[model samples]
Target: MYHTWMRFFTPSPLHRRLGLVCLGVGLQHGTLPTVGPRTLDHHVAVVISAGSGWYRFPDGRRTTVTAPALLWLTPGVPHHYAPDPGTGWDEGFVDFTGPVTATYTELGHIEPDRPVVPLADAGGPRSVIGRIARAARRGNPLLEVETSAAVHELLVALRRARADTNADGDLVLEALARDACRPLTVAEHAARHGMTPAELRTAVRRGAGCSPKDYLLGIRLGRAKELLAATELPVAAVARRVGYDDPAYFSRLFTRRVGTAPVRFRAQQGRTVPGGWSTRIPDAEHPPTIITGHV
Candidate 1:
């Protein structure tokens, strides 16, 4: 015998264009019945938080599942799994699909080949699943967007939870991100780590799912955006701080990726402190709205 709760969604074509849309979510425990040797048209992430189970491979091999593990059921891929008969398991899963799924896969967030992945902890993924569940309530106006956002969070959580990479403590990624502001090439970065460029590339791919240059650019651009929005520094100073010596080049790249020039972004975001606190405070009842971004 087993216990289960689940909800399914049929999102509109427009919702799907939002990059990642959740199709379903569920919680299951106990000695669940066997699932099919079946195929699907989308993807599902079954986060097993406790107990153990087993799943079948396309070639008919069976792999054992343990607590704090993940099962990636991808589109057009056959899957069959069940919890251990007596001990059973607690599992939370989210089903999602969209154009961004391809990018996530390229970045190694969605591993179709590695169906079962061991996790360092289930707490993070479980939390994201909870968010999806709460957002799944019927007639909720923001259901689609909320759940879709949660799906993105779930992917990051899963990536961080991976037992092997352990993205949170990944020394390589951490070092790269730490030195992201340095004007260094991928090869130079590799040399500093005593790794060949190819080896460093492979490591970054396994840990962060992107090439070294791309990863560094992502970090650099992110910091440039923060400086542009919050700091009073000029564009050239901001560019230098983010490892770009040439302000014009930095502006071009920033505009290409962010779809806006640095000066324009700053204008739109405005200053949070606005030349420090004013001597006169605004009325409490009519306090102005404030906004900020992580990037």
Candidate 2:
């Protein structure tokens, strides 16, 4: 299911702008070594595409390593890592160093404190490493510069790949689905998921093909209809139950959106048609919406 290799690099920087230069590049999968903890003079980024492992830090802090993640081996840090034999990882690594690397750390772009960064784009790191490996193999003129360019790109890719897992739109959708009746603003919903309103809107639009506010309203209306049909709750009670503080406003909105008032809609559902009472909810013109919302 997997294959790999490890390559060492010896790049001579062709220019100063090529701040970060690759020292070595390696690819490994399903391999284990019983070597002791080692300290390196150069920084190495190990991208894991599959399987799991563990990384032991110099401070004696050990962290679990999972696939689709980045394990950063910072310079002068005593660290050791190995793939789980039962589920050895598909790994691609690049050893790099330069003055710009320190700048990267200061900018919080490369988090030395966080050794394990779970990757969001599973194929991204692998692709970067694959490019570096191919460059290393060719041993072309300006290989140093070419690899250095790739090294910079690698860092950027790694950073992008380590997106906040919680900020993902699916989580927001799940939360909204769970409590659509909760009275919360769009900003509050986004904040709950560690995102800004704009970010939440973009994510929701991409994931649900609808605005966050619209989605929330959809869920609220859906829940309100359920309560009106399944329960004996009054109009005002149903309005409040579905997050509307003022029953008059709820009734007006319900009438506008549903093509009928809430009371009449409930009555229609209560009356028997031929075999069953089929009260069509509002928005039949639109496709079924995911009426759930969460931050």
Candidate 3:
């Protein structure tokens, strides 16, 4: 049996806006006792990677939790859960909160009252959780942003897992989305996907309701906004990072697309410091502890 746990020392505003800011994560196997019947302040997603357990709720409702299943513990909800020590279980859990969480709840993607969500496969979820764990261990400079991004991916993966199916367009869309972040031409992206330019364009239009060029630009612009609002990088650096080679051209395009210059956009977002226009969060060095237990 094995167990591990990690806690973040800080949180970021952008993470909060996305409605999924990770607070802590844990993984454990072997006999485990029930945690609480008390109300929790933040939502907790507990995934049973393997084995079995039981979940108990406030109204005296109880149910069995099996492997490859996700359990949602909503904020202010009283709950308790434990593994059947006789059989034991492997568990991965992440605690998170954000304003957008309500949107998900409203959309029926996550039902607060439904505690247990059985998953057909847990591999994707486990991999994402593993990534968060590793990033925590590395003490990455943008830990908050990095973990937040992982949480976003986790949510999407959870939804897809629950659907238990995929559309062909989804693959093309995913490929385009990932490749868009780099400085790759549409033809290059098409070639990488083993498709002609026209085929790629059609796939993107069918999937995203936009032409390939527009879709890529949208991605680049969205990333530019994030960098502008959340980081201290210069305009040229930000432009280059988002795949633009010439800062001058990037500025013109940004102004044309976003209707505001990059620097001015940053100012509009928020002052970086008390008196400065920069909004970059200083990446401070931190030493985090990782604990593992065996029985």
- Top model number, TM-score: 1
RMSD values for the candidates in order, in angstroms, are 6.0, 15.2, 12.8
Top candidate by lDDT:
1
In candidate 3, residue 143 scores what lDDT? 77
Residue 82 of model 1 has an lDDT of 91
The whole-model C-alpha lDDT of candidate 3 against the native structure comes to 0.78
| lDDT of residue 12 for candidate 1 | 96
Better of 1 and 2 by lDDT: 1
Best-first order by lDDT:
1, 3, 2
Scanning candidate 1 in windows of ten residues, the lowest lDDT window is: 276-285
Deviation from native of the Cα of residue 155 in model 2, angstroms: 0.8
Stretches off by above 4 angstroms in model 2 are 1-4, 13-17, 165-295
Candidate lDDT scores, in order, read 0.89, 0.78, 0.78
lDDT of 1 by residue, 1-295 (tens): 7899999999999998898999999998999999999999999999999999899999999989998899999999999999989899999999999989999999899999999999999999999999899999999999999999999999999998889875432688889998998999999999888889998898898987889999999999888876766667789988999899999999999999999999999899855476553223223235566767664
> What is the total number of backbone clashes in candidate 1?
0
